[model samples]
Target: MPPNPTSYDTASEMAGGPGTLEGMKRLWTPAWIARHVAMVVLVVGFLCLGWWQVTRAASGNTLSFGYAIEWPVFAGFVVFVWWREVRHTLRGTRTERPTPAPSATAGSEPAAATAGVRRPVRVSRVPVPGDGVQDGDLAEYNRYLSWLNANPDAKPGDYPG
Candidate 1:
């Protein structure tokens, strides 16, 4: 009989196979633990800040500048960290798969892709009468027509209609 193939395949396909908890524990990697810890820290920090502010308001504080002052500083730090994490994610830091790099061959497709393609956007064109009225005046004219149509029994001199 042929020897059993190795359980592991590609880096992306690595997963906990059916076995004892010890085997699974070995696969519980440091990166995974760090991810979970980071998530918990973010959630807990947000909740604590919200709870503190609510408590402060309930305590009948005359002003809210204390929370406001610190909120921006805290928010800025979070935003900076999140941006770096996103950049790393886009760069595929965790995955072993290599992203396809642009080819050196000069072609229209590559040039268009790199230089960016411009799409023609359709804009609504309401033709204004050359001698009739300015485009801005059409709004008031529409209002008048709508009023007249709604109140057919009312005379022209009557309020609006």
Candidate 2:
């Protein structure tokens, strides 16, 4: 028998409302279905055992031994099935494809300015120390010096203008 919808629905909704096919796929995967099936089987088996024992008592038949034997066998079967499902899930399926990076727009400023010194400084040519003077490095350093030189309301000796 299928699970009661109201319980499953409330459970699913609490777990994020069945947003996508991938989410749905995870919910109803073979491993998941097998686990639920095993659980239902165990519940039914136990109920049947209880009913049988009660009915035997009513009929003045001592079914204690019969129930004790049958319940364990059914329970073992259910446990074996559940173990298989757990192993299958642990082995795992449904690999996620790598998500692509978003396209950059011309209007969007790169985070270089706000990001400050931690950001990668793209020098036209990286300077090799003791390789005389690199023009690109000299140019960038001069631009920085000029900016430092001009700001009037700056602190006095902090960066000598």
Against the true structure, whose lDDT is highest? 2
In the range 59-158, model 1's lDDT, one tens digit per residue, is 8874554773465557556657755664454334333555566675765354334347576799879864587656677777888878888889988788
Which structure among the candidates has the greatest TM-score? 2
RMSD of each: 17.2, 22.1
Off by over 4 Å in 2: 1-27, 54-59, 93-161
By summed lDDT, which 10 consecutive residues of candidate 2 come out lowest?
11-20
Name the runs in model 1 displaced over 4 angstroms: 1-29, 63-65, 68-80, 92-161
Q: Estimate each model's TM-score.
A: 0.29, 0.31
lDDT of 2 by residue, 82-146 (tens): 76865455434434456655666899855443334685677768745785755888777786677
- Give lDDT: candidate 2, residue 160: 46
Q: After superposition, how far is residue 16 of candidate 2 from its true place, in Å?
A: 19
lDDT of 1: 0.59
